[model samples]
Target: MSVHSLNRLIELREREVERLNVEVANKRAVGDRYRRSLERMTALCEGSGASAALPPALSLNCGNYKQAMLGMVDLHRQDLALHEADMAVSQRALDAAARKQEVFQQLLARRQAQLLREHESREQKRQDELATQVWWRGQR
Candidate 1:
């Protein structure tokens, strides 16, 4: 393939890598939000005061609230786990795209080098022919 085509392919790969990076970042942000929310819920559960001095009704209400908050925290943990899994997949995709871009760049470099050598060889041959022609004319 031509160097131009290889460059285009590399650009495409770069875009893919960039897109995957964004996806991973967004997933990480979501995970962070989930974690913060989980922390708040856990703190609320821990801070609940069901003191024996409190009225029975208030104590019962506090117990119910703690149970509900615990359940919400568990749900948040599950959500965070799922988001982490998705982020891992995005990271792998980004790695593969970067590797592909590197390979294409290497191939383009080799091709350019080969083309330069061929051009230099042709120029050298032409100069040698011109020199030989000048020598023959001098001999005459």
Candidate 2:
């Protein structure tokens, strides 16, 4: 096809690749945060269990312990939400990248076909010129 259309396709592919990279990075970050939240929850459970063995007065700030656990629960929910959002974004990016990759493959095929045609045309013209030169020399 035309150069302009090819260039546009290339630009689209580049943009899609960029967007995909961003999304992958974001998903990775979200996964990391979710894992950390899980770790935090485990740590909180362990801490509470350990503190339960102590006397009430010294059981790891008894008055505020419930509130702290509640906060952790809230964070756990938020982390889950972030993870889901990240997954959706990652899926979209993957889809877009796949589409762009297909377009790139099509562009490559078109270029290859054009090159083959040009090569054959040049070879045919070269042979014709050589044949004409030989015939003219023979005539002379």
Candidate 3:
């Protein structure tokens, strides 16, 4: 491809890579939040056992509290699972985008190098022709 076309393609690929990076970051943040939420749920469950020293009136709701905690923990677990799946997919997508960009960069570099070599070859040929003309003139 022409250098101009190659440059445009590289630019497009760069933009795609940047966008994918942002998406990956966002996914990571979401996953982190879900992980923290799960951790908090676990801590709460652990701490609930220590609440047994409460007054009799307050202790009466222990069973209900435990049941509710169990439900919340289950919900958190489900959410964490879904988040993990999403993170995996996003990570794969990011890797693909990065690879594509790398390919474009390599292609662009090769094209630029080829152009430079061609330019040098043409300049060398021109110089040789000039030298031959000078020699012919001196011989005359």
Candidate 4:
């Protein structure tokens, strides 16, 4: 393929890589938030007091409190799992995009080397012709 086409492909791949980077970052941020929330919930339930205080004027039976906390923790766990799955997929996409960009760059490098070799060969041929002409003139 032409150098111009290769350059264009490289540019497109770079853009794709950039976009995937953003997606991966977003997924990670979401996952981080979920982790922080789960940590807070566990700390509140497991901290100093045997029975953690509920919000103003509200209270639950011992059985109900445990059940509610368990349910909330389970929900957070599920949300975290989903976020991790999304991050994994985003990471895969980023890797693929980077690989494509590298391939294009390698192709471009090969094309440049080929062009340089052709130019050098032509220059050497021209120098040889000049030398032959000089020898012929001297013979005359």
What total of clashing residue pairs does each candidate reach?
Answer: 0, 0, 0, 0
Cα displacement (Å) at residue 87, model 4: 0.9
For candidate 2, the per-residue lDDT at 21 reads 79
Per-candidate TM equals: 0.93, 0.66, 0.87, 0.84
User: Which tens-of-lDDT digit does each residue in 24-110 have in candidate 3?
Assistant: 798888878977887887787777784568787677676568778879989888987887888788888879888887888888899
Better of 2 and 3 by lDDT: 3
TM-score of 4: 0.84
- lDDT by residue (27-68, candidate 4, tens digit) is 888888998999887776665244346543344454466567
Question: Could you tell which candidate, 1 or 3, scores higher by TM-score?
Answer: 1
Task: For model 2, name the residue pairs that clash.
Answer: none
Q: Quantify all predictions' global Cα lDDT against the true fold.
A: 0.90, 0.77, 0.84, 0.86
* Models ranked on lDDT: 1, 4, 3, 2
In order of TM-score, best first, we have 1, 3, 4, 2
For candidate 2, report its TM-score. Answer: 0.66
Which portions of model 4 show Cα errors greater than 4 Å?
Answer: 51-63
In candidate 3, position 30 carries an lDDT of 86
Which candidate's TM-score is highest?
1
The residue ranges of model 2 lying beyond 4 angstroms of the native Cα positions read 50-71, 74-78
